[model samples]
Target: MPTLQIREAIREAMREEMVRDDKVFLMGEEVGHYQGAYKCSQGLLEQFGEKRVVDTPITETGFAGVGIGAAMCGLRPIIEFMTFNFSAVAFDQILNNAAKIHHMTGGQFSVPIVFRGPNAAAHMLGSTHSQAFDSFYAHIPGLKVVSVATPYDAKGLLKSAIRDPNPVIFFESELMYSVRGEVPEEEYLIPIGEADIKRPGDDVTLLCWGQSVPTALAAAELAQEHSDLSAEVIDLRTLRPLDTEAIIASVKKTNRVVIAEHGWPYGGVGAELVDRIQRLAFDWLDAPVARVCYDDIPFAYAENLEHLSIPQPEDVHAALRQVAYRD
Candidate 1:
């Protein structure tokens, strides 16, 4: 095993896939000449050349539509939006054409494309640039949403997403690009829609994904230190085809749960999880499911205010304590 930053893992996944498949190509703003906005595609331009690694104008819709069209014509295109908030500019193409093409054509066509980029709030980046669309994109019928937390999961899941013959919405966190973790050198693929129990415990289950996975883990450790409350942490690696079995099993074992994410509370992803857990494991639960999510407001630009806006480790700890009846 080798340690790799999230960005490096992502680049390796794309690089390996491009080498494995001739039809695979990357197209986005600043990807070719600038080596990617966050360096996720660094060294790709020189290795693959300008044709495979393209730089488009700032227009998200144009490039997204281009990717969708290319996919329909039998190419695997990885389209990157600077941030998913900017992806709103290309929502119609993503939701309408790419998502519907396979079903609308009676399986005559498949959109083997990956729309990937950093998502959610980054330090001091205003409301427009720092929104998470996990819930929104997961609502689509044909798109598969993959939100990654660790370098290992990033490489494995991205590799899986690229091979699948469907439109995959790969959401990464801007705040996690530098986070390092162990990744194996040999080829691997983590199946889509699987939940990983990062830590097993008996008192409570801390359900989370993406950037919040680390937050939940920290909260679990803090809960153990402060009150001897053992918290099991489940990372829902993929959102749309959520691993309901893993969630129910964890909830049944722990008897309490706290959901956390960097998204708004109203109709958030946590809300859906709460609904499923209550319905499937209602009798097993000892307490109502607690959630740690953003206060339903636009993201703030100030550093302190921004920090206060999204879910934090403290929030998770508090929620875990309440749910575990250790408050």
Candidate 2:
């Protein structure tokens, strides 16, 4: 086993996939010469050459449309957005074209493309760049969405997304790129639509994904210090086609759940999880399901205000206590 940063793991996944499949290629602004805005694609240009690792202009819409067209022609293209905030410029290409082509053609075309990059609030990046759009993509019927929190999941899930015969939106956190975790040397692929329980518990369930997964795990550690309350933490690796069975099963055992997300409280992935639990596992719950999310206000540039904007460990711990002790 080797400890690798989340960014390195993602780069390795892309490099290996490109080598394995001739149809696989990468294109985005600064992806080739600049080695990616975050350097996640460092050294890829030299290894894969310009044809495979391309640098497009700063036009997300144009490049995204190009990637969709390439996928239709039997190429697997990985498109990177400097940040997901910029992806809004290409929303029509992503939401309408890439997401609908296969269905519109009655499975005659498969868009095996991956649109990925840093997502969510990082430091004081402010209102425009700090938002999380995982729920928005998950709401779409044809697209598959994945947000990974650790190096292991980053490698495994990205590999899986690249191979799937559909468009996948892979989200990585800018702040998490440097975080290190153990990753096995052997090749592996974590299946889509599967939930992983990072920590097993009997008292409460903390459902989270991406950066919030680790935040919930930390809250579970702190909760152990206060009482014998064990918290089950579920890492929702995929948003669309959510592994509802895993979540429902966890809630059935714990009898209470607290869903956490790094996005706004309304119309977030956490809201959907809570809604599903009530619909599917209502009888199993002992108390009302609780949710932990970023404050509804736009993210502020000030560091202190930014800290309050996103979900923190203390917020998760408080939510856990509230759910655990609820009548």
Best-performing candidate as measured by lDDT = 1
Q: Which stretches of candidate 1 lie over 4 Å from their true place?
A: none
User: Over the stretch 65-133, how does candidate 1's per-residue lDDT look in tens digits?
Assistant: 999999999999999888999899999999999999999999999899999999988888888998989
The C-alpha lDDT values of all candidates are 0.93, 0.92
lDDT for each residue of candidate 2 in 1-327, tens digit (9 for 90 to 100): 899999999999999999999899999999999899999999999998999999998899999999999999999999999999999999999999999999999989889899999989988887899989888899998999999999999999999999999999999999999999999999999998998999998999999999898899998998887655789989998998799999999999999999889888888888888889999998999888888888998889999999877788778888888887832
Q: Which residue ranges in model 2 land beyond 4 Å of their true spot?
A: none
**Model 2 score (lDDT):** 0.92
How many pairs collide in each candidate, listed in order?
Answer: 0, 0
Q: After superposition, how far is residue 251 of candidate 2 from its true place, in Å?
A: 0.4
TM-score of each: 0.99, 0.98
In model 2, residue pairs whose N, Cα or C atoms come closer than 3 Å (at least 3 residues apart or on different chains), thus clashing, are: none
